[model samples]
Target: MSKLKIGLIGANGRMGKAIIQVLAQSQKSSLSSATVKAGSVYIGFDSGIHSGIKETGVIFDSDLVAACKGSDVLIDFSSHTGFSENLSIAVAEKKPIVIGTTGLTEAEKMEIQTASTQIPIVFSPNMSVGVNLLFKLTEIAAKVLQEDFDVEVLDIHHRHKKDAPSGTAQHLKEVLLRAFDRKEENVIYGRHGMYPERDPKEIAIHTMRAGEVIGDHTVFFLSPEERIEISHKAQDRKTFAVGAVKAAEFLSDKSKGLYNMFDVLGI
Candidate 1:
């Protein structure tokens, strides 16, 4: 069988470089094209060499449309600024896309929902398999603990990461909300001065940006009797890259649908 050709966006970012390395070592897929911002210095550079690997003859460019047209599937790790354009080009070119971008606004998320009716899309905030499992475990714990346990989430990432609370942390928040049948109003960001007492139904998310930590998240459920904590720590960016490649491969033959890492992992 022919290897699936993958087009990558934001080929100059950290995740992009990791994906390029993964593709170079993949037996089921190959990097067909890579895109950077228009007029950027990285344009015209070999994707492999830019990613610190041996040459693979795939050059970086800024033409998203051409990249979509030339590959069997697309993987976008670009910033939220170019997310709509990348998504639009994928829909226009009738190509499946695996979206790993975060920090998208609600409107951009709605755009993805609308576009999924026309083409297959694997949209996920965190693509690490371990993180997804953390999501599942948190849900289970929430269901079992109910309102008896006070819940709080801790998210830690590299200082260079732009978004607060990380997308993975937000997803963990969503999972808790769903499990408890609560609304967005029931969530809290962090605590400040003294209050009367903690709300049993309130879910708290705390974020910390420290030196060079890839990613770390822990969901804590505390009761008067005991405490339960479920966590996942990412040691390398390649974990997410592997899952992104798997998501692209999952969309290789699908026509139209909105899917997530749960779908890709069959969880």
Candidate 2:
């Protein structure tokens, strides 16, 4: 098979740079273009310099259409806004896309859904295989754990992460709800002083941000005797890089549709 030409959006950001490293090192794929902001210092620069590879012949650019044109897939590890703007261009080009961007608004999500009619896209907050497994495991645990146990998800990330509760926490909530017959009275956010009592069916989510921790997550089933914790800690960013590459491989040359990591990994 020919090489899977991947257009990487946000190539200068941490995850974007990590993906550059991944494709350069992996024998399976190559970067066709690395898209950065127009005014980025890295624009017109070789991706492999800071990406730790001498050169892969792919230059970073801010031209979304030129960057994605004729590519097999576009793997986005950029901001929601950048992804939002780039998405339409990808669809117009009929290129597949794998989105690892977080913090998308509801309207932006609807835009993605509309774009799916013309090109395939995989949108997920976190693409780590372990995190997807955590999503699945939460479903099974929530169903069998009985009414007494409370489902609480806790996530910790580097202090620089701006989104509270993290997208992973919200992903867990969505999956856990699938196993329940009824909706909760409320989704209890980080409870504080004068907080009301916890509802048995409510999914409580908590998050901690500090230090340089890569990412650590725990889903707790709290009951009288003890607590059952199912967690995944990402020691490095490569796990996500691998998953993003996997998503690219999954979507190449396919029909138009919206998908997630669960679909990419066949979970």
Candidate 3:
């Protein structure tokens, strides 16, 4: 059998380069091509060498339709603008898409959903299986934890992140609402000024950015005398790469639909 030919978008970015490394390390994997945005300085560079690995002759091209011409699946860890354009091509070609991009607006999300009806698209706020399981666990924990305890989620990302309260933090908030059967109004973001006493019905989220941390998240159940905290920390980008590859493998023969890491990891 032939190896899966993966066409990677955002090949010049940090996460994209990491995916290339993971693919190179796997014998059963092959990169069909890689892409950066048009006019990027990395257009003519070898994909592997660009990722600090031995040369593999895969040049970073910006032409998505041509780059993905012979690919079995396309994996993207790119930005929203690039992804939106790529989605049109993927839908037209009826190819599977594994999107790891964050910070999409509601309209972009709707676009993804619309495309999923035409092509298989695996979508998730966080691609790491550990984080997805943590999301599911947050629900289970919220269900049984003491009502008096305050639920708080703390997420830490790298200093270069542009968005506050990370995507994972927001996803955790959704899990809390479902498990606790509470409304969005009950969730508090920042409470500095003389806000009154705590509300047991509300869940709070806090974000911290520092250093070169890949990602770290914790959910705290705090009571009078004790606290129970659940945490998941990503030490490297390869974890997401591996998880994404697993998701790609799953989509090989699957029908068109939208899926999250929960569906990929079966949590």
Candidate 4:
């Protein structure tokens, strides 16, 4: 059987390099092309060597259109700044895309939702399989606990991560809100002095960025009887890379739809 050809966008970032390494070792998919920002110094370099791996013959370039046209699927780990263009190219070429970009605004996400109607798209903040499971578990716990428990979320990542309350944390907040059938008004970022009291419907998300932590998230459910905590901590970026490749593979045969890791994992 022939391996799936993968065109990667944002081939110079941290996740980009990790995905390149994953494609090098993958049995079901291979890197066909990689794209970097325009005028990037690494533009003409071999994608594999630039990613710290042996030569794979795929060179980094700045042509999103060509890359999208030449591959069976596209995996985008690019910054949110270029996400719309990436999605547009994929849609125009009619190629399925797996999006791993984070820190997207609501407007940007609506663009993805609109684009999904034209091509298959798997968009997720964190593509780690374990993290998706954490999402499901959090939903279940929130449903079972209901209003009896006060819920809070903790997000921790590397100090270099610019976005506070990592996208995963935001997704967790959404999950909790969905399970509780609450609105955004019930969610709080963090506690401050002089608060009257905590609302049972309130969900808090706290963020900490320090050191070189990959990612860590914990959902706390506290009540008078007992406490239940659901957590998923990423030890390496490879977990997300592997999941992104898996998402690409899942979209390879599809035509049009919007999906997430849950759809890929069938959880």
> Best-fitting candidate, measured by TM-score?
1
Candidate 2 ranges with C-alpha deviation above 4 Å: 182-185
TM-score of 2: 0.95
Residue-level lDDT of model 4, residues 1-267, one tens digit each, is 999999999988999999999999999999999999999999889988988999889998999998987899999988889888888888889999998888899999999999999999999989999999999999998898898999999999999998888999999999998999999999999877889688889999999999999999999999999998898989889999999999999999898999999999999
Candidate 3's residue-wise lDDT over 1-267, tens digit each? 889898898888888988889899877778888989899999999999989999988998988898778898999888877778889998987889999888888899999999999999898878888888898888888888748678989989999987877888988998888887889999888668897788778788888889999999999999998898989999998888888887887788887999888888887
Model 1: per-residue lDDT, tens digit, 7-113?
99998899999999999999999999999999899988899998999998999899998888889999999999989989989999999999999998899999999
Arrange candidates by TM-score, highest first: which order? 1, 4, 3, 2
Between candidates 1 and 2, the one scoring higher on TM-score is: 1
lDDT, model 4: 0.93
lDDT (Cα) of model 2: 0.84
TM-score to native of every candidate shown: 0.99, 0.95, 0.96, 0.98
What tens-digit string does per-residue lDDT give for candidate 2 at 180-222?
Answer: 7656455778878885566677887888999988889898999
Ten consecutive residues with minimal summed lDDT in candidate 3?
140-149
Give the residue spans of candidate 3 off by over 4 A. none
Q: Pairing residues by index, what is the TM-score of model 4?
A: 0.98
Total backbone collisions, model 3: 0
* 1 or 4, greater by TM-score: 1
Superposed by TM-score, candidate 4 places the C-alpha of residue 146 at a distance from the truth, in angstroms, of: 0.4
lDDT of each: 0.94, 0.84, 0.87, 0.93
